[model samples]
Target chain A: MLNKVEAYFTKELKEKAGILVVLTLLLLVPQYSWRLFFLLLLIASLLPRDVHRGKIKLMVSLPFSKGDVFWISYAFLITIIVITQIIGGAFFNISLSGIGWDILGTLIFSSAYFGIAMISVSLGFGNFGIPFLVLIADSFFGAIGNNWEFTYNLFRSPSGLNPYRMISPIYQGNRFAAFVFAAALLITAYILFERKGTSK
Target chain B: MIVKVENLQKSFSGKFVLNGVSFDVKEGEMFALIGPNGAGKTTTLRCLYGDLTPNGGKIELFGKAFSSKSKERIAVMNEERETFRRLTGGDYVKMWSLLYPKWNDKIFSNFALHYKFDLEQRVETYSIGMKTVFYVALTVASNADVLILDEPTQHLDPLIRNEILKVISNYTLEEKKTIIISSHEIYELEEISTSFAIIKEGKVLYSDTVDDAKASHRLISRDEKASQGEVIGLVGDDTLVKTDKDVGRFPKFEEIVLGYLGGRREFIPF
Candidate 1:
């Protein structure tokens, strides 16, 4: 069990660590911050595909249980989330000041997204899930990109967009959204990780 | 029994890659899966090692029902370069060894020594054959009764190929371990395989013991006048059907078959 877990981290997270750092640096560079969320989704989905690919042929031939799938996914997601948090905050300057609510949101987003990426890339045949994920994510990203200043007003940013809209005035709209992003990811990850695949 | 697959079936796009495939691997038996490209051989091997989930199959390993998640009894030598390029061969083995409950560094190092694999060098600098040797050592080090190998000989030199096969064959004989190997080299399989299965076009065309496969079919050839026996085999650039049999020395039969296979074909002249 420990070996599987370790392999999951090393293969899915550590193996991709360099890329993750490079990507985080890319996201932090002022103007390119717009690409951060979408890139995050893409990177998360890409990590485990190779390991899963190698295993897909064997898993289909052998006997696998849902619990095994869930654990594998969970293990992978945690590593990704931890890496994302470390890189995002330490280097990219993605803050986590007040908004205690943000942590819950981050955890959720991390879990959901980690799971989503796990299931999406783990598909046996085509890239059906990727397009589906991109369709929804791209549109949302587009909305945010075009109206970065506008969304600042809606979800009640900590303070940047609106002087008195939210209690934690120090929190920027992007910060709150990151937490929400984390929440969204968590919900999705758990669902995908738990969902029964067509195979069995 | 080391492993048992019951009523296994895997489908993609409504087509079954492995359909109702079932079998028992006796302890210490070296089994081979021989089939054409796109055959269920790789798929079947994947299912055995927890790399895939069968649409409908139950696997019992070491007297326990193995669900998709229950993988405490098997080891797999997967295809996509399991070793991290930056890590030394020894470190890679040790890293994985820590995770496996059944890992035995002694056995792994012994296999590495036998194979002449350099343990101190970074894995990425080595060739594919070297990586395979490292993977085999790590997997064997796990000491899992069941070892699932997919295309272990792909891209391997003849000498290395024989060496790996020798290790697997010898291990199964000396220890009561079970190995499932998928390969295109039917003749090499003939030498060491106790059981065999053939997959073609995403299905199990036939699966049985080596003796049964040999007994069930005959490889007869003709110069120009072919017999009426149905074609039941693949010969060079043609198919051998008994009913439409025009068996000539398939252009370059000996050279083509042996060359492509790395000299692993056993022909029965008829």
Candidate 2:
């Protein structure tokens, strides 16, 4: 079972390049955009790990409870976030603390990406839901940013045409709100996707 | 091991593909679900393997009732398995093993090498017979008590076909494993099958011991068109008589076929 899980990341799924692609976009691009990173993470987490119907059934049947699958999938999404942060820190010639806001933003984005993707895809939605949910979160988070007490202080206010304005991937004091954002979008995705039948 | 299929009923729309089919398969016996196309043999096997859900009925393994967990005792090879074109043959087998709860890697992998299987070779390039062996080897290595093989010999050369049969015979006679196999290879079934079920047009025609099949039907034939024998279904231009009565000489199916085709007219055989 240990080897099986290892194999899933290594052999079964080619995840390393996906992680690398997200990192390259995050670090090298002149204008900062968390959306692309979020998008990549969404696809990595949600896509059917196995295309064959039988193989898909087999993967789901691994000695894993439904909860185990849900959380492990969550952890893999986070790993991507961590990898990106470490890489960004290296490229910026700074240590972890110097790149604090970027790390925080990535974490927030990762959780939101995973929560929504897991809910939607497990409930049988497709890759499109990744961008859709992220867009909804961006709008809703922007609404919160304008109305709330904290977002004004947490982000240093975006430079013009900045993509970060769309969502408070992180707000300083009420950081717990990130979880709320993730959970709400996830719940919505679940509700919508679950409406489809399991007859097939 | 006792496999009791209780009132299995599955249908699409109002048509019942499998209607109330039930049978008990005993341990160490070669059982074939002989049926024409669409006769529910595959459907019944699918339900037994937990791949399909019947509208009604249940399967019992040993004395316990069947459940999803009960699948650990069985390995199923689908009739037309979608072979992964990208993965190597070894990896393909390994993936199947991961799905198996009792998956023993050493035993299965060793057998692959013993068969001179190149694990590095991709499955898309494999012949249909090699692919079948790939599926079967994974199951056999799991040491599962029950093997549900559908159309096991669909595309095998004669020698490879014999190899598979030999493997099956060893498992049943030596290891005392139970098997439920469905195939059109009637001649092979006739050789190894102890108890058999005949299914046609999505229903079971009959199920009984091989000896019973031999004793229950008599082929009555004569060269003379005037001669006649009591039977349910008889076909052909020549006059042929068939009867479901015990006969002395035509005890085996080969003899029965020969008796039907090439026998001389006889006034009586007592």
TM-score of each: 0.65, 0.66
Give a tens-digit lDDT track for model 2, residues B101-188.
6678887776687667778987767777777888778767767888888888788888888888888778788879888899766778
Displacement of residue B69 (Cα, Å) in model 1 is 5.6
Off by over 4 Å in 2: A1-11, A14-200, B9-17, B65-69, B92-115, B200-202, B216-270
Cα misplacement distance, residue A76 of candidate 1 (Å) = 6.4
Quote the true-contact fraction of every model: 0.28, 0.04
User: Least accurate stretch of 10 residues (summed lDDT) in model 1 chain A?
Assistant: A163-172
Model 1 DockQ, alpha carbons vs. true complex = 0.20
Estimate how well candidate 2 is docked, as a DockQ score.
0.10
Highest TM-score against the true fold, candidate: 2
**Residue A37 of model 2: what lDDT?**
47
DockQ of every predicted complex: 0.20, 0.10
Q: How close to the true structure is residue A181 of candidate 2, measured as C-alpha lDDT?
A: 70
Model 1, residue B179: displacement in angstroms?
1.0
